[model samples]
Target: MSSVQPYVPNKDFIYRAADALADSHLQQALAKAGRGFVDKRSAAVTRVPNFEAMRDRARAVRQKALQDLDIYLLHFEKKVTEAGGQVHWAETPAQMREIVLQLCARHSATRVTKGKSMVGEEVYLNEALEKAGITPFETDLGEYILQLAKEPPSHIVAPALHKTRAQIQDLFLHHHALGERDLSAVEAIVDEARQVIRDRFLRADIGITGANLLIAETGTVAIATNEGNGDLTATLPRAHIVTTTIDRVVPTWEDASAILRVLARSATGQQTTTYTSFFTGARGDTDKDGPEAFHVVLLDNRRSQLLGSEYQEMLHCIRCGACMNHCPVYQAVGGHTYDSVYPGPMGAVLTPLLRHRDGDYQLPNASTFCGRCESVCPVKIPLPDLMRKLRNREQQEARFKGAGYWITKVFCALAASPRLYRALTSIGTKLAAALGARRGRFSKLPLLGGWTAHRDFPAPQGGSFQSQWRRNGKAQPPVGACPAGD
Candidate 1:
């Protein structure tokens, strides 16, 4: 049982969420990144004709890929082998780490530079590299900042979205001795980071990046980055390794193209990334510069088990960060509150599936069910639906804590018998209607005071729905669903 971010141990999700809500610095950081991501994606999508159609195409591509995942993956592996690259399959993070470490050791790698990869985060590759005594450098500006600060990423696309400009300035000033260089302007800060990591790309023996999309038709892996670091990281090193999950494999370059069209627009609101580089395999005799050895390590990590299951739709995510930007809960509490490699709506459904620790189920409860995450998702993953499913499953499994345990047990018991349920609700509603008609709403309740403290709970105007339905005689249920039995 390895943690998602080993450097930072897990904490109680509810407590962390409360802390996140209270922290002013975190509030400032969330306010800065949340609005910008939403606005940029909104503006970018508007500029494209049939953006919704593009999303539909991308969603179809993913669904088709996963539907025939085995065919595409085998085809991808064969293509890689033909192109003078090796493909290694890992069923777990440990196996993936071992595969990568063996690759690094074989290459005699002492220095490694990494592109920003959530797959890398999922496997905790940085921690593995450090434990193996290899010096790993993060080339993405946001990743580099978090690396220097020894913190896990808050957002997937923008890792340091939780850090303010002032905070980054302090990190650089403490870590580097840049003399009299004004690092106040945003451009200056970017320049400073560029200067700092310029040589790591050249000196590194191994470069590892995550695949944004993998093409089975051409045996090519594509990476998209705002910074050109991914290009340098992949090309400059003696060996290149792609650390990605098996779900990234698409059937063809056309399918890959379909996804790429939406990836950048949803991520940074750019039509395309500044550098969307594709690599097939090792450099040939005629090629001047590229990695001598190329490897694509596909980590399963329980993802293959999800195929044909209800949760398989999660595999469609493109890591655009659009869901997080639009998510009210994520905007308020930030990614760190989820305490997983992933955060926000995606993580709420994913973290528990990947790592079901004590508090993992709590993530599904973090949502407001506003459906914003689903609305903004480029792949159209039913995130709210998935989260609701997880929440229901958790309660059914009785995986709750303390007072919540008994409370949920009581509620579930009450809900099991239709007769008891209708009878209890009939009496309760009548009681509330009669008592609270004067005030119209309850300011406090025994168990729901926290909710009532902020807003009044409306008193029921009459008997329960079942009672009213029977009284009406010709009444119908909403949406034409069959009426419940009593």
Candidate 2:
């Protein structure tokens, strides 16, 4: 019942992306955040012997779980009930929010501490909590930073990834009462937030966390976090609730371990998270720790419909941010531009399927087709391929009369005949060459202002491939490397 309605702004990707590209502070933040993740992942996998093999195993585990997802989910539910915990099925975000509110009301919970939950973000759970008169404190540092800023998470793992250190300093100064504390260092900033949230953790009436893996064999919920707050939040409170989607479940402990191995390597480039904790139901009669009541609310939200579809592989995703980290478009503009609870390549594929009315068809065409997303995927979800499929779906459905539809239609017409394509491309190249003769690059152009407005687009130099091939008598370039433009 605690799932929040979508707080994510569903804006046109083109307009928002233009705004993001023009934002200097956001640009700095993206540059700073993007490289660290890429380098760390490279290093982490380099350290592991045959990391590819581990990824293969993880992919197999996920595929197997998805194949029999219903069976595993039922097994998981049975185990939870046997361990004295209840399972609630939420078909929609509203149902999820209602279920959580009822649990909070049952316990008369006024304050709740929460670990990072992407599912919560999907539902805008924090907003719902405030609406319900329950104060929820975010214990994770990244989530806490974003909460203070009153911003939705830009990136999944690093929710505040689009915030520079200076911006964070400003946020803290505005939010906290620090007379003369030296807050120059990143560590100091984190410590200050830790000190602030510590009391909330101890005093909260209930705790809610998202599960990284749900094991059917033991009906155990596992969470992996850099901060130890998840363990504290779950065990310290009188009531514990796990809010997550059904796709998170796996068949057994071993399968969970296999996913974890790649999950760490893919996410943050660590061999393991700083704290990986597991919980089964509530505290036992002889046990002195854990909440008296434990509940798991699993949201379907049409994910079950994707079970046998082309996108079933998407459910295999481990929520690792690797795909976005390696994405050039995301690196350039950052997450908020996508205007989705999920962003980047994964979001480009999933968001449209989940909420088709979000004007997200343009998302599929957001790729350069580098395929880094598929290459780096822990569970190997073919992100680019899925996006391509969505693109085809959009074309078939004739969803919109936007620029993409017309452009794609023109391209398709041209692609049907080599002669027409060659003739048109030759004329187009020569025309572009003549137009840019003064500068050798275009600062702006019709239908291409998205790229040209921010940066220069190098005009065609040598000639179209057809002309060059005909002139050179083969696939070799035309004699001159550069055209007369410059």
Candidate 3:
């Protein structure tokens, strides 16, 4: 239904990653934002005595919701209808775009204001609206900056985290028509954005936002934000449209509370986001002020198919961005390199499953399997395991081949035979140590040029573990008893 060109994924993620590594501006932005998030989250967690227990509770809530997803969804729809709101089910991105366009058409909306909605980006809703002769204004400061720059979000919670303050000032100066004024401070930038967005909000015919959690019991769409833009976006316009996925539904407000307990702490390290607003359908006769018409567009987009699949655990994601915040790979390459709306660890698993296209298969292979993503996840989604499963699925489907495949096969074969493994490892370690003993590190290696390309690889010290164990009077286990290890 969208007249715009179909979204083309950037297949050159490796190349993009290389470019990101070379980008000084991106590197600085990443370093600054990454440390801030890590420190804040660490401090926030320390304040809560039972943060781990809260994570367990959040995981249980999500798991229970997913187990009976259909029931909760039905109940959600029933409550929305009871509140005089309409619920539209969209099985795919195309269907979602069409549904939203129809809703806009019903209201004859020309100017739409939006709060930060990743689902909107997932479906390319802004482009669709543009094609339909509708103008959508992004109210969130980060999202607004990206909109002006015509770029995708670089971070989930902080969508424009990749941009520097100087870059933002330039963007605002170029896009905003309000005669150049002093824009040297952070307050200046926020004030300017506020002034510009306030006018747009007042003139908007429709407001669109994403839901953090949907409570089936009361058909309440809960949104958490620091800017209060979501509240304005949901309340100001004549019509309010909630664009979100089906996986966001929970059985009750109490379940929503459990997830919220972890969401803010994991995201911005605040005990709670500044503004937490709830919307239930349209404004009633007794209501003082609210949208006249309310609609919720629930997008499946392969999520229903993923319910019983190996990737079902991924649905537990609360979009806290903590996994990505702590991911070393994400820090190095930045979100844009992933070339998907969803980036970082969560994106590595999600983009491939949701998109399922060529080049996307490389995402799962982008990790070092350091397991920090899983450690920081609020819901404790096994990100590393899911990525491994994706990699396995790729290999099973023969999506990976050539040198990489043969190398893995050779390693597996060698690893299967303990005698061969120990012999090769001993010889390899001794050879590496001998070769790099002068420098204590290898600046270059025959088959591992890529590893040494960025930094020196530490030379192995002394004999292999098995050899040292034998030298220390430890009895050697049977050949197959010890798994392959260095």
The candidate that achieves the highest TM-score relative to the unseen native structure:
3
Looking at model 3, report the run of 10 residues with the lowest lDDT sum.
Answer: 1-10
| 1-486 per-residue lDDT for model 2 (tens digits) | 132234444468877887888889999998778589999999999998889999999999999998888899999999999998999999998889889999999999999999999998887788889999999999988888888777888888899999899878777877788776777899989899888899999999999999999999999999999989999999999999999999999999999999999998899999999999989999999888889999999999889999899999989889999999999998988889887778899989988988776578878888999999999999889899899899888878874577767887889899998899998898999999999988999998987876987799998897896687778757564568677985
When 1 and 3 are scored with TM-score, the better candidate is 3
Per-residue lDDT tens digits for candidate 3, residues 348-394, read 99999999878888899999999999999999999999999998888
**Tens digits of per-residue lDDT for model 1, 244-273:** 999998998889889999999998899999
Candidate 3 to truth, TM = 0.93
lDDT winner between candidates 2 and 3 = 3
Q: Which stretches of candidate 1 lie over 4 Å from their true place?
A: 1-10, 399-423, 437-439, 460-486
Q: RMSD of each candidate? A: 4.9, 4.7, 4.5
User: Which candidate leads in lDDT?
Assistant: 3
Per-candidate TM-scores read 0.90, 0.90, 0.93
Candidate 2 positional error at 213, Å:
0.4
Worst 10 residues of 2 by lDDT: 1-10
lDDT computed for candidate 1:
0.90
